[model samples]
Target: MATTTESNPPAKDSKGLSSLNEFNLEKSILRRGLATAAEIDACKAHKAKLASKDESKGLLEIMVEARVLTKSQSMRLLKEAGEANRRVEIPGYQVIEKLGKGSMGVVYKARQTSVDRIVAVKILLDALAQNKEFIKRFDREAKIAAKLSHNNVVNAIDAGDVNGLHYFVMEYVEGGTIKDVLDKNEVFEEKMAIRIVMAVAEALAHAHQRGLIHRDIKPENVILTKDGNVKLADLGLARLTADEKWAMSEAGMAIGTPYYISPEQVRGQVDVDIRADIYSLGATLYHMVTGQVPYGGETAQEVMRKHVDKNTPFVPPDHLNTKLSSGLGVVVETMMAKNRENRYRNPDDLILDLKCLLQGESPMIAGQKPDDLATLAEGDVEDTSRGISEAQLIEVAGYVNGKQSVIVALAAILALSVITNVVVLATR
Candidate 1:
């Protein structure tokens, strides 16, 4: 274990001689104890070999071999990097269970003593404490997310650094991500898909109004709650345009997941704006409704290139699963248009279109001939009990008509008999 010291001794010779000798000796020891040039070179060679053998070994392994960070440290740094700012505590929040693990850190489900409520506690690795770039990015995530408050967006409660480890606390979303739902159920119906997408779009609009852009928008980042609500999480790569200090200074380094990246991001455009997010949202919606990505590539680089250079694939409802409506196809295609200008300009526009779609309106072209709702085939709708099918409604209507006819016939017969009886009594 490393020893902690309160302060360093003053550099002074008792005999009034120069203190340079002692300073030099200390510096020499520190330099020797640190990673040597030969060791760094060896680590690099090992990394190259590993990369050649297994392409799946993530970049974190290279950082670890260079003595820049340990495996645990790298994991922690990535986890805390994504969380919003909050106080870090040790032994403060009791760990109830581990929520999940990501590339950077492990998330724990804990109970905060102060509030007596459950929160997700993310712990960063101690090795990353010396990495300034990671620290800046980590802190910025919390600061940026804290500025925007929306029901659809996950809220950050607190952040802090404890000992050498950094951590952040966030509201615990009880349900899993949309990805989980999709894995279990391959595709979503038009109405259910529209509802989920609209919630996410509203959340994005709220953040956009605050000059915040969620750079990473994908199914994995969207959570579906048990209460039938959608929550947007993971704002680690989100950018605040209005804040000059928060602007990214790094160039050429891609910051988003390859599959969901926008064309602007793949092209390394520093001025990427809200439209990029619109494209990602479109891709997400496409995947949810059609059960496939807009484009498929064998490698990450190839995937990113497709976003920049290739046209989005045909996504008619019959293309993937025949159950989807053609109108849903049109909405996805419009949102995922290759040209940014052709896509929805803002989240508000997308949300409005989604709402219109849910209300049986033509979202793509206003005043255009509406599709025949009666001809639309029913797919497996999310069994939320609230979804009423046309077949069920028809059955109910038939039952009601039969009952009404029987009641009318019985009343007529009773009235005729009563009239006959009254005439007989008058004649008598």
Candidate 2:
């Protein structure tokens, strides 16, 4: 335990020296201490004279000297106030300190009293609480995040309101976020980078299958666990595909960080599907591999304006990193295509291609037309139960038999086409 004098020292004035006063006394000790109201009043009367005599003396010292508070009482009060200021005690949870802050709310590292488990608590800012739209989005985030149980998605535990404050709790991840890693200028191996993206892609596929669109997908939202697992977080901008709610932003207003905004998202279109996240994912990969966004501008407006312009071409990852594989460049280019139709038709297409690339096989991107790419066989596209494992593929293929195997066989055919194409590129 820290000494009272050390923990609650005298506050500095303009000259950086202690000046004994009522306000400082009240805030640091007197308000919660055993000091009587009359004693406090008495101290205020002589505070000015005491302060002038020795500007370096703290309020607590003056109070003790004037008998307004005994030395022991002053010490006790300092300790009490220090503890109170150190932690924010919400019902059932002890908020240790602030973990992170965002436009919507601030996240705190907290401990749940009952279970003694560490968790993250996000408290809505008072200004946003007054806005019905922000409240709606807050509530929607908790609901949607709670419903999702993917390994790569942060788990929402509980949500409640206390004394007009809205807060939601989630499982605390100790390893921090991808943004933290990128901020350090860390470079990732090609396979490791693709693996991390694959984890997020799988999570997106699950959410997309459930009709939820995560409008914002950036490095900051992706948390890395201690065991090298990825956990996508922050669903405040998520929206249900089936819900006909009013657009969060008005006409000509684009939402999401400009660094990873999709072209449709840049247009401020409210009816965007899962493809928007795919574009953002591609942008994230571009940053991860090349250390820069495809488009650059001083302001978000200028960056978004670049996204809206069809004439601006995307710079592939290889242009920035000459050592990167040509196949990886093709995958990034396919995902970041300005025209949504030209992008991966669905999350599965992206996931399939990524899995193929990870396995040292050619990715499934050849002469396939966008229209044909959009129509994936029924159960194959929406199955979020497992990943792109051979066993999982066999299980889905078993749903149909014999000649109908063409549905399952199509995935293999796509991979085979890419293999031939990759060989041609290698020869060149």
lDDT of 1 at 394: 78
Cα error, residue 83 of model 1, in Å, equals 20
Model 2 TM-score on a 0 to 1 scale: 0.68
Best candidate, lDDT:
2
**Per-residue alpha-carbon lDDT of model 2 for 131-171, expressed as tens digits?**
98888778878998987889999999999888777899999
Q: What's the lDDT of the predicted structure labeled candidate 1?
A: 0.68
Full-model lDDT, candidate 2? 0.76
- Please give the lDDT score at residue 408 for candidate 2: 66
RMSD of each: 17.6, 14.1
lDDT of 1 by residue, 203-287 (tens): 9899889988898999999999888789999887888766554445644557688878888877766777888888888888888
**Model 2: worst 10 consecutive residues (lDDT sum):** 13-22
